[model samples]
Target: MRGTPTLLGRPVPLGEVAWLTVVWLLLWGDLTVGNVLGGLLASSVVVWLLPLPTLDSGVRIHPVAALVFLVRFAADLVLSSFRVAFWALRLGTSPPVETVRVRLRTSSEVMTVLVTVALSALPGSLVLEAELEDRELVLHVLGIRGDVRATVQADVTRLEGAIVAAFGTPADREEIR
Candidate 1:
């Protein structure tokens, strides 16, 4: 089933095994026959014992859009870092922090997870909660004095657009729009 090789009437998840093996090798920082064999054995055991739910993921990288996404992400990271630092160093009362909920454009599991991670990575904003069923995110944002909800929602929407443009299929992009 799933075009995977069967072992004793069960499908072997070769992709998961290979990915786990690679991770093991990277962690061990060695690439030898013994390591390879051990990784394979260990990964096979883990895959069989602790099976993960299969997901389509639906990720496809578009070079141009990916580059754009990376550039924008880097810029946001840097700018937000500085803004947080400035807020920290400033004298007087603390900046206002507000929690807001923003509805996302797409609700694909992969897309939702990516957006959540991106928002958390930025310095001034953190994803407090992700409601996948409702296609929404609850965020805690710092240093916003005016129209906090709108600003946070717009930022999340833009980030979601960039992510969809970079890795989403045509249908996925349409869902976001």
Candidate 2:
């Protein structure tokens, strides 16, 4: 409802339609015309019955930026996977571990949430806590080879750049450091 709007005086339920289509596709496993028609009918009925939200503010996406974000995310995932594997294979020794605090550039809640989610998904890094009021994040990291502070800060900056590229409005060349 927050992200959607009403049509005329009533809400046009696109969410219900989408759900019905998915359920029908899953249950029937057939893409025949009759099945498609039935699914559409069911979806229409559900939408008519339910007070669904409308898409007033449509989604804005930048294709090139989205592609770049995906590429960087995949590469980071692979690198972090290898780092985690290497750390796991360490023989009878605990690596230097520390929690580093990183200050984020963008104060966007969406950007912050995305960064936290992506960092958590990566293997070698964990988000300990995020201080939204201060615009900082604490990360628990393993295998501190060099300056932990600098490394963590750089990592967070990279993540912030990726998020900005993906979601932020198009901008001129502005260094996010």
Candidate 3:
């Protein structure tokens, strides 16, 4: 059972609800029932109308682990922001740009997609393409340095590990081999 719970063939995760409600509250700027219900209704409609792929790769969110991932991701985001700012401010110093291939550890399409999205969100890196056939991702990095190849590879692996630890079942963790 993943974090997303299904009701009447509709998937609704708590995060989705919170996000929707918060957006609605911010927009309406109130705590009235109408706004709350409106947000819930809107979220429900979207969740029901848009069909998301069902992930059956034994993904289950561990609350603590997921929280840990969130914390680390936030910290990384702050650090990445600073690095990106530095790159923007620097003059006449073109960072080494290169495309690196990273072999993903998982065969699960869900994990691959998750990792790809996560890595893409990091500054200076973009997932150019993923070869699901070989479970590898071709990444374009702007300002790579210090054994960039190994660093990128390790970063991908670490992100994948964090994701698996946070939202994968025991069997899935074992499959991390």
Per-residue lDDT tens digits of candidate 3, residues 24-134?
Answer: 889998899999999988877776677566566557889998998898888877777777778888897776788999998887777788888888898878999999999
Residue-level lDDT of model 1, residues 27-125, one tens digit each, is 999999999999999998887778787766699899999999999999999989988888999988697899999999896888888889999999999
Choose 1 or 2, whichever is better by lDDT. Answer: 1
CA lDDT for candidate 2:
0.77
lDDT for each candidate structure: 0.90, 0.77, 0.82
Q: Write the per-residue lDDT of candidate 2 for residues 50-156, one digit (tens) a residue.
A: 75444432223567877898899899889888877887898887867888999988766667788899888988789999998898999998776889999888887
**Candidate order, TM-score descending:** 2, 1, 3
TM-score computed on alpha carbons, candidate 2: 0.77
Question: After superposition, which runs of candidate 3 have C-alpha atoms over 4 Å from their true positions?
Answer: 1-58
lDDT of 1 at 32: 98
Q: What is the C-alpha RMSD of each candidate to the true structure, in Å?
A: 4.3, 4.4, 6.2
Q: Once model 2 is optimally superposed onto the true structure by TM-score, how far is the C-alpha of residue 116 displaced, in angstroms?
A: 0.4
Task: Output the number of the lDDT-best candidate.
Answer: 1
Against the hidden true structure, what lDDT does model 3 obtain? 0.82
